[model samples]
Target: MITIERVSQVPEDFLVDNPEGGAFYRAYGRAGIPDFELGCFIVKRASRPVTTAPFFIMKLPLNTMMPPGFLKTLLGRIALRVAFVGHPSADVGRIQGEQSAEVLELINSELRKLAPLVSYKGFDGSLGLAKFNKVIGLPVPVLNLPPDYWNRLKHKVRTDLKRKLKASAGLRLLETDGLPKEHLQRVYELYRQTCDNADIQFEQLNVAYFRESAPLSKYVLYFEGDLLIGFHQLLCSKQIMYCKYIGMDYGKSRQYKLYFALMLQAINICIRDGIRQIDFGVTSYAFKRHVGSEMHQTFNYFQHRNAWVNALLKRLSFLLEPDESELR
Candidate 1:
């Protein structure tokens, strides 16, 4: 037997303790926006000493550009590929729960039934419980640096870094415990523009999000002669620095290279704090690869908890494979 429940139904303690669940909730909870479910999915097996997997929902739950039914079709496609999709490296810490073999089949079928409506690279149900018990396609560049080592970065990358440092000499990059009320709107505006330029619908954040996150995080922003041109946010785990959010003025891409410099700055901060690795987040950008960031596999897993659906997914796999495309 299998069981599913809304995220609210899950107890608070579990979400608090499980890092994966917490991250998922924070990212999709629209930064605490009201009326948005952000649609979290939890699965459990109803057998002896029943087991469960971490609560999961669509990775990019909001795609304003896509048609309303697109995600549903995508999710269905992912269900068909659950058995083959790899694990996500970005989500290192996951909530621990009982894994269900029976539920996998059920999920497969349900996904196929909804094929025309959702989209995903793979299903969290199938991939999460397998090798990593997590999604396996998030491309986070993890770096382990040696002591006093600015020597390891590629030469071109180093040269570019030098240029950025020289260009932004007048603008000081200081660690502020928090932003002033006046500066808050400016920062938020830049952030919103950055998201819009990329056609990404980021969860709208109020002043509280910035106020709360800035002090707790080691973030970097670039100001050119008193004008803020760039900003990036990062989270420091004991040995890992997770690159949370990034934004920069579009025109500065070539001249300033603020994004690349921001990453290097993060690395330098990591070295000072004794951080061993950096999780660059999901996408594989050119700069990430240029700096010798290793590509670790991550995956989405899914299982439809219905008998007929499972058989249908299996039968539809071949026909659906060509239609399958990555979420990014």
Candidate 2:
């Protein structure tokens, strides 16, 4: 018989298979993000552990992709109490078990007890394992570069990248295994500012997470003369560089095209390290595409405990999809 249990936390050995996502669960755990109540689900088959997944309870906005107006604002304020099936602490949701379809459906049946809305996020779009309610996710962008990358790109592409780099010519670069303690507060402030200015909002990371997660991340720091202007966090695998998060002083971002310069810098870093691909994660569609990054499709599976609402969501799922242009 299969059984499921919900716990406030997991043992240290949970999800040990993917060590490459260093400090991920530690930094983005139960107490990591604001307004998130992380739920750890332990699924056992015949009393043997099969999967340990992180879920969350939060208020999810109903009005996405709507124009900025009274209708949007009114609907935005009206959120649903949602129970998410994957790790809600990060941009993508991951549930590790390597479970078969039958096991996944069993797990799903158990999780539906949590709230009106239950969704599994950050899975590859190709994995249509279950025929549950499906929402197409924002495309994940990545840059695949080879040796002599600059020379291989079209002439116009090279010229544009060069111009962007020239704006930040005076800035100095510092690459470190982790952020120094002395610079934590400033970097955290920049992170907050970036989140505040963003057009879409999700779970917000706290400074506590940044401080604790500092040691496991690879940082690319930007210094404008003596002043620090920006920094980006990366988690690297053998051949792929996951550009996870970034922080920047927006006051100087336009002055030096800081974000663009940072991407150029990341490209250089990837080339130097022989990292073949740069996974820029999601969002910032225009700039990502301009840099020759291709979008990889992902999906979120959801359902509502109420039969009527579940049917309603299926009908209105179109409102939750990414624009066709963003898919490019």
Candidate 3:
């Protein structure tokens, strides 16, 4: 028999011991994602030791109008399908041994007790997680740097980077663990602008998220004179430097080619530090591809406690999902 335990907080040692939990969970408790509760699910099987999975539980509303009598009962069933559970961030999920199927079954069983629907996000496609749930592919671009990485870049990319570097001479790059409140506020604004301009929207970071996550991250801030023009948040763990977040002044970004400059800076940092790979995150596929980044497919799995609803979701998922062609 498998028993699952939910806890509001996880022990520090648990994170230290489980490298499979990945780096995002290392500081997730303090990241302050809105409308989500940070917690871990412990899976215990009879005499065997326990396994833990960290996740963000998102409580969703059943019905805003509190349906009357029979209507309430009917809509409540549908509402149960509204609740969601997912990884705290990109590329994090773990289940031990041959128990991936069992763990997922147990999780879905547990979620049904609270809500009708639940989804696990950001599992690598290579895991074969699709066997038990409807899986969708979300490909992310990554750059694997070989020695002399700079010379491998396309001619156009190299020329563009040099031009941008020369044009950005007035800018000073500063790495810091914290930013002033005003600077933080400007960064937030640039982040918001970047999100607003995106073809597909995802999480929008708040100031608290940045302030709290700063300790685990290296903030590469580009300052033009006294003004903050752009910044890149690089999450460092082991030999991988993930380009987790970025923000820039839209108007000046185009004029001075701030994006190219920032990307080049990130590459230079990785080369100097001997980082193996850079997870460039999603979107901006063309530019990342031109600069030698390869595509790795990520997966999201969904299931509903109600078999009928689960079947319907599996069929209609394509309509609601993004077009893979967009990545090209």
What TM-score, over all chains together, does every model reach? 0.63, 0.90, 0.82
Single out the weakest 10-residue window by summed lDDT for candidate 2: 14-23
Q: Write the per-residue lDDT of candidate 2 for residues 54-113, one digit (tens) a residue.
A: 777888887655545676688887788777766654556676665667667766676677
Shift in Å, residue 111, candidate 1? 9.7
Candidate 1 — which residues are off by over 4 angstroms?
1-5, 9-30, 33-36, 39-95, 103-138, 154-157, 177-182, 199-216, 251-254, 301-328
Which one is best on TM-score? 2
What are the Cα lDDT values of the candidates?
A: 0.50, 0.76, 0.67
Better of 1 and 3 by lDDT: 3
* Candidate number of the best lDDT: 2
lDDT tens readout by residue for model 1, 1-328: 5665434423344345333334434443334443223333356555332332233222333232233355645643332212221112224434335434455444333444433222233333343243222323334456666655567767877786677666656555755434555566667777776766653242455555665555445558787768777777776666667776777777764577666677778877878888777777654356666665676553433334454664564454333321123223
Query: How do the residues 227-246 of candidate 3 rate in per-residue lDDT, one tens digit apiece?
Result: 89899888765567778778
TM-score of 2: 0.90
